[model samples]
Each structure stands twice: as structure tokens, then as C-alpha cells.
Target: MKLSKYLGYIFLLLATLAACKKDNGNYDYKELPDFYIDTVGVQKTFETPQSIGTVVITPKVVYNGSESNLEYLWRVYGTTADTLSREKEFRSVIANNPGTYTAELQVKEKTTGIRALMRYTIIVNSPRPYGWLVAYETQAGGSTDVALIRSTEIVKTITTDVVMRNIYSEVNGGPLAGTPVSIVSNVSSPAADMLFTSQTAVRLNRPDYKKLQDFNQLFVAGAPTPKPEAVMEVPFFGNHLINDGEVYWQYSGLFIGKISVDTKGYKAAPFGYAIYGKNGGFYDMLNRRFIYMEQQLSQAATYASPKAGSTARFNLGNIGKDLVYVGIGFGQNGVSSNPDTYKYAFFEDIDKSKRWFYGINFTLPDQPDLCMVDISAMPNIFNAKYFELGTLGSVAFYANDQILYNFTYNNATNTASTPSVAFTAPAGEVITSIKLLKQPGSGYTGTESKSNRIMYVATWNAATKNGKVYLLDANPTSGSLMATPLKVYDGFGKIKEMCLKPA
Candidate 1:
């Protein structure tokens, strides 16, 4: 009986196998369409400026399939991936920031569900890459705007100058919220432009001038009071921000990171100077002294008591006067000289009756004081509104109302030249801002003649409610302004501050 059951099971398996072999399949098969993109004449890379009209790119797509079944797409990859077009040709204005980007083109066949892709390198340049960044307040002090005196040449002669007004508003869609105070460009690694106002502060990306971070995002701990004073940057060293008389700093690096407050418990003056290979210098308003801080450290310390019996002109730790202006001074020999070692600090007494100029070799270890002289006898020293150190020579420029005066100081003799009129504005206009067009990096040698030999003077007229910016050629040795300006840009708001933005 077991043998018979086994035979029956084998017979059943044989019958099932025979039935499956007799059946045949019934399905249809079709070949996929062949398609390719012809890149023979297609541009593989594109270089354009921001808002330079339209950037058109036409590609030749070869396909053996139906043209109606083909779909096209274009995209650019930056900080964020953005779709540019859906047509076969890319015809649109690429107003991306001044940086490198990757663009992609995708062609798809709907019927075959197949796609082909090609990538391209895109470099967007800034139209106003190098210029004079002017921050100004609108009429009635309602808000603030920024302008750029666009330059055509990067090095050599400045062929042309065009004033682009409302730059911050043109890019940001509105004005900065508050009265303008200062505008500074950090021409170091991870370059940025810091704009300060009474109510807020903003950091803008360089070249493109796009907003990167605001006050809250700039600080690691949190935003401080909105009394923004100044933002200072020492190329390749560090950056410092003065807010509410407090100092916050960040070391120079690949990224613009958050800054931490200096915990030394000192009130820093609004303006300070920094040397490339040495510690940064700042005036301690509360202690009435000078303090120095290393680039990598947060705590600032006073310079060691000028050796015990040293004939130091003035003690660095005990300069009991109000700091009016402090800056690195360039000698008459231009930037080739050891200008980094020379520093100047101008001060005033408590009653503002007397002012003094202290020339020091900041790089020296001890007794850096070169000379100290009372500059009160100089013309317009008592009622000067704006002060600027000359980019070359031992000279200084100060403005009193509409009159701008220039005087040379002799560090060796502890004497100063008689103040001479550099430029006089119109009768009704008052000098608002004066700045030397000097950049901070050693790599700017190619453009030294243009950058280091120009001065900017901004004036405002109350009656006409007009503002004007004058670009004047500066005498390298005498630090005197040319009788006629190279160019004059009018039709602006009340100018508050101006700084050089180099390429």
C-alpha cells in the first residue's frame, strides 16, 4: 500500500509539470527611445555680474523621440539650490551673490521616463565690487541708507566714478532701521561689511553686499543694547565691535562666527587701532589708560608701567585724558616705510580747553612714546567736528564747520606745523565726514597709488537739504588736498560715515 501511494503522488507531480509546460505567456515588449544632449557648442561656464540685465543660455538637445514629450529644467546650486527655468533655454537674470555656483540642466522624456543631465560652472561677480561705502541718514533723520562710489578700475587710474545711492535699500528692499553711525568693511578672511546705527546693527557679505547676520545673530550670548558705536577689523588678525561702550571680539578665520564679550571689565573708547604682528590697542575710558589685547585672547591688559624711571613722554597705563582720535600713522615715505610701528593718539582735557597729540612707536616693547606735543595752538583745534589721520606723512586733517585744516607733526622735534586750509566747503554746507581712502592689507600694493592717495570729504547743507561727497587727490608728503576735487557726487542724504571697500 505504501508503494502504491508513492506512485500516485509521483504521477500527480508529473501531471502538474506537464500542464505548466503546455501553457504559453502573452505580454508585450517595447524598446526605449534614445536621446542625448549635444554639448558641442553649449557653454560649460558662465561669468556674469549681479543684475547685469539678462543672462541667456541656449542648449542644443538631440533626441530620437517626440519633441512634445521632452521636458526641460535648469537649476543653480548655491547656499540654497534654486530652480532657474523650465524651458529648453535658460533666459533669466541671475542676481546671485558674488560667488561661485553650480548650475544643472535636466532633459527628460515623459514617454520613456528617461532623463539626462549636464552641469556647468557659474561665477557671479559683483558690479560694485570695490568702492567707497557711504552710510547716511535720510531727511528728517527718519532712517538710514548706504551708497557706493563705484570705481571702474581695480588698480592704476580710476577711469570713472558713479554714485549708486540707496544701495542698502536697493538690495534689502528698505532702509536700515535707525540713524546712521558708522560703516566699516572687514577686508580680511571671510570678508564682511558692518553697518551700525542707533537702533540696530547688520553684517553684510562682501562683494555682493547681502545681509548675512543681524545684531542678535552676531553675538554668541545674546544681543546687547542697540547703542552701536563702531566695528573695527584688523586684516587677518581679528575683529572687534563696540556696543554700549563694551567690546566684543572674534578671531579671524574661515567663517564669520559669533563674538564673545571681552570680560576684562573695561569701557573701551569708540575708536581703536590694531597692528598686524602685534597686540591691538584700545583706550580704556573708565581707567583713562591704554590697553592691548592679543588676537586670540579675550582679556585685554594695560601695557607694563613704562619701565620705572624711563623718560616716557606719557604713561600708556595712565593717560588721563579723553581720547579724541587714535590711529596708525604712515610716514612721508608712503607705505614702504615702517608705518605699522608708528601710532598717534589725540586727546582733550576734561574741560576741552586743551588738546594734545601723542606720537608713539606702538611696536616697541618699552618707552614707545616718540613725542608728545600740545596741538591746541593749531587753528580750528578747539571746535573741530571730524578728525582724520593722513594716510602718508606725519599729518592730520580736522574739520571745523565748513573749513577743513591740515597740519603736519614732527615726531623728532615735538613740534607741529601751522594748520593750513585743505578745502573749504560752500558757505551753507557743513563738513559731515572726512576719511582717508586707505586699505588695510599688504596685498593691496597694486592699487596703493589710488587707494592711499585719495581723501573723501562729505558736506551737508541745512538750508538746501543736500549732501555732497568730494574725492580729492592727496599730497603724499605734505598731506595737503588738491585745490580741485577729482570728482564730486551730489544728491544724497546727510552723510554720516564713509569707508573704503577694496577689491
Candidate 2:
């Protein structure tokens, strides 16, 4: 019979055979091959803290080489490898979880029995936070070597930004909970495309205003009116920026809400301009409710209250996204419902003021690696800079230490560009000892005992060229000075400032 003619019959026969196939299924079950399992098989390992690992078997793995069941099993010690088997698994473990381990597989090939195994060990851990970091100086010192850097906080590991981050808050922490404070960031120029890197603040003079009121009411025996410089010492640091939230101010008895600082030319100066908003988050640990403050009725034509009267805006620089800058300027307003508000902004009674803005500018030194700042490559901070100015978080994070004025200055413009005068100062040098002290605004300074001896690179006030050199102390008050006056060239005419190469 022709195969085509009997095709249906043949199919039926094959089906019957398949259907009748053994209930005990299979020609033969392939068992894993057995090669004496070596005590030490292919293995990989890593160290704690940080690690990288690899594994190698005795006979280097070969493609299409092994004659076995062709199976791989990887296990992490106590766990079962059969449960977790993927084509290829890369086990990246942190340094903290450490142990010895192995990956074993039982292989068997019916045609040719062959067997092998592989394993690797790994350890992991989180990195430790450094309590102190070295603060390198880009300007304002007369040393040729590394300087001292102290801890900015007693407790550390504080996340730099809160939510929406600003410049000052980017560098420092946020405005404290209790006290009412406001911060700004990434303030550039609406007209000029620039970034702001400087972190600045402001304080209101309430006590002084009360004192002044008392002075005006003096009956020749009443409490003396306090001076603007005397009563208030409320310090406002650049707090973290809030990408979202309304502003608040601490004025007029209660927490006044709906007050914010709007800064133009925020970090986006490269493309266009950047602006920022900020508010005081009043934390009442006792009361529990976040009592907002009032709209800071800025009565002065200051930077904070940049209005028609005054021009106190200073250029920080073309700030980049790495770090943001924030500043507070004061404006003047005629006495009204609250005469006290006038005193908060000390600039209201300016005899003659310099057009110095809160000075925010983004700058890239010729060598940022040496100084550690990229003026050109600023980070992108749009949501934070404009929208959530009130949120608190770090806008910029430094790998190690951070110092102000890290980059070199170009004297193209005298604002901050000028190196300034660097003449030998009078014997009253602040550095009385060679030991260093980390300052908040200023950099490390020599200790009282040792500072007086070591020489320093410094700028001097000029035109009234006096040979006398006075060490600018951390405090406005003239602190201790060196016993002997160092004879140095009148640098006022030569260079405003000079950086000392590491000696």
C-alpha cells in the first residue's frame, strides 16, 4: 500500500502507541554526574565597608564544554539555591552583611556524565560619616599649607536640603524651629543671567525698637532707649529652601503668616533667571501646632524689601546648580501702626549707605578642582528655587568639606572680584597662636596663643594708606594681637589679596 493512501491508518496506529505509552513515563531519568567534589570549589569573595568580587573554578569555565545535566545552583549559605535560580545573578551585598559562602550545583548528562560547581563570598557595610572635614581656603589667608576645619554641627549626618532647598540653607542648616527666621536662595539678576552662591541672612531689632520708644518717652529718668545695635541680636542664617509653602514672619506680638521673600535671578541664571521663596516654620514643641508668622512688613528699602527708595543689591556671581545663594536686604518705610517695625531693618536710618546688595553671584574659578567649584556646571534647582522656597533640604552637597569663597577672584569688577589689599597687619593679629579655629562665616583662624606668630595673607582697607596692620577678629571688638608688628610690604597698592602656596 502506498504511504499516502495508508497515511490515516498509520496516524491512528501512532496515536494508539502514544496513548498506550507507559504510565511510568520516560525512557530513563538522567542522574547528576559525580566527580569527587573538591573541598575548595570555584569561589569569590569581598571585603567589608566597600567591595568588588569574582569567582573562578579549577578548570576555567568553558562554553559548550561540560558534559553534565547542564544545571547551575547559586545559594547564599543557609538559603536554598534551588528556590532562587536565574540565568545570571549578580549578588551585590553591602559590607555590613559578611560571611563565607558557596554556590553548588548537581549536574548530570545522560549522554556523557560530567559535573562541576561554582561559589563566591561577599561582605558589605555602610560608610562611616566623618565628624570633621578639611576646609580648603580659596581666599583671605596667609598660609601656604592646608588649614584647619572644625565640625559645623555638634551632631552630624544631617541631610543638607529639607524639601525645597535654597543657597544659604544649602550651605548651612534650616531656620530654627522656635525663632521666626526666613531664608532665600539662588538669587540671580532678572536682567543679567547669573547664579547666586552666597548664603546670607537678616535679623529684626525688636528690643532696640522698644528701647527707642522708651528713650523717646524718657522723663529724664525712664529706661534708656536701646540702640539698633544694642537690643536685637536675632541672627538669621540661610535656612534650607522650601520648594512649596507660604512664608511667615515673627513680628508684631504674634506669628504673622503669608510673608515670603521673592528673589529674582535664582540658580537658573545660565538659561534665564532664578527666584526663591521662604517662610519661618514656627515649631511649638509644647503647643504642637505650626503657628505661622505675619507678612514681614518690611518698612525699609533694604535688600529684603527691595523697593523704590534704595539700591543695596550686590552681585553674588554667576552661581551654578551645585550650590545656591540667598541674601536678605532691608528697606525703609515711614512709621505707621507699628513704629517698631522700622527698627527691625537697621538700614532705615542710613546716613550714607553703599549700594552693596546682599551680594549673590555664581563664579567658576579657572581651576575648580583645585578650589572645588564649577561655576559653569550648576545643578538644576527649578522646583525648589521657585515653587517650594519654603521647603527645607540641602540644594548642594560637598563631597568632603565646604568653605565660603572657595574659588579665586578675578578683579575684573571690584565688587568681590578685587583681591583687595594684602599688606602686613599691625601686631594685633587675630591669630595669636598657630592652632586653627573653624569659624562660621570666616575660615579657620589661628588660636589665640599661636595665631599671633604665624604670618597670613590678608586684604587691607586702602587710600588712607597706613602702615599699621590690624587683625580683624571674629568679634567686632578688637581681640588679642601679636606682640610685635611684622614688617611687610604695603600690599594695598600691589595686590588686594594673595593666596599663600602650601609651604
C-alpha lDDT values of all predictions: 0.76, 0.23
Clashing pairs in 1: none
Which run of 10 residues does model 2 get worst, by summed lDDT?
387-396
lDDT of 2 by residue, 399-500 (tens): 111111111121123222211122223333221111111222223333332221222223223334321112222211112224333322222211211111
For candidate 1, give the lDDT of residue 476: 55
Q: Residue 179 in model 2: shift from native, Å?
A: 29
What are the per-residue Cα lDDT tens digits for candidate 1 across 1-503?
A: 99999999999999988887854559677877668888896678888877554777787788887789999999999988899999998888777877788989999999777898988888888866667788898766768898888654223345566677887877677888998878877655536677888888888866556677887877765556778776656656655677777767655422233233245557778876776464466788887877776766665667667777888877877788988888777642344366374778788997888999888666664787777899899887888878887655777888888889888887768888898999999789999999887653223465354554778899998888888998888875688899898888888889989987765
Q: Could you say which candidate leads in TM-score?
A: 1
Q: Native-vs-model 1 lDDT? A: 0.76
What's the CA error at residue 495 for candidate 2, in Å? Answer: 22
Candidate 2 TM-score to native: 0.25
Candidate 1 Cα misplacement greater than 4 A, ranges: 1-47, 51-72, 77-82, 87-123, 152-158, 252-265, 275-279, 331-336, 363-366, 439-448
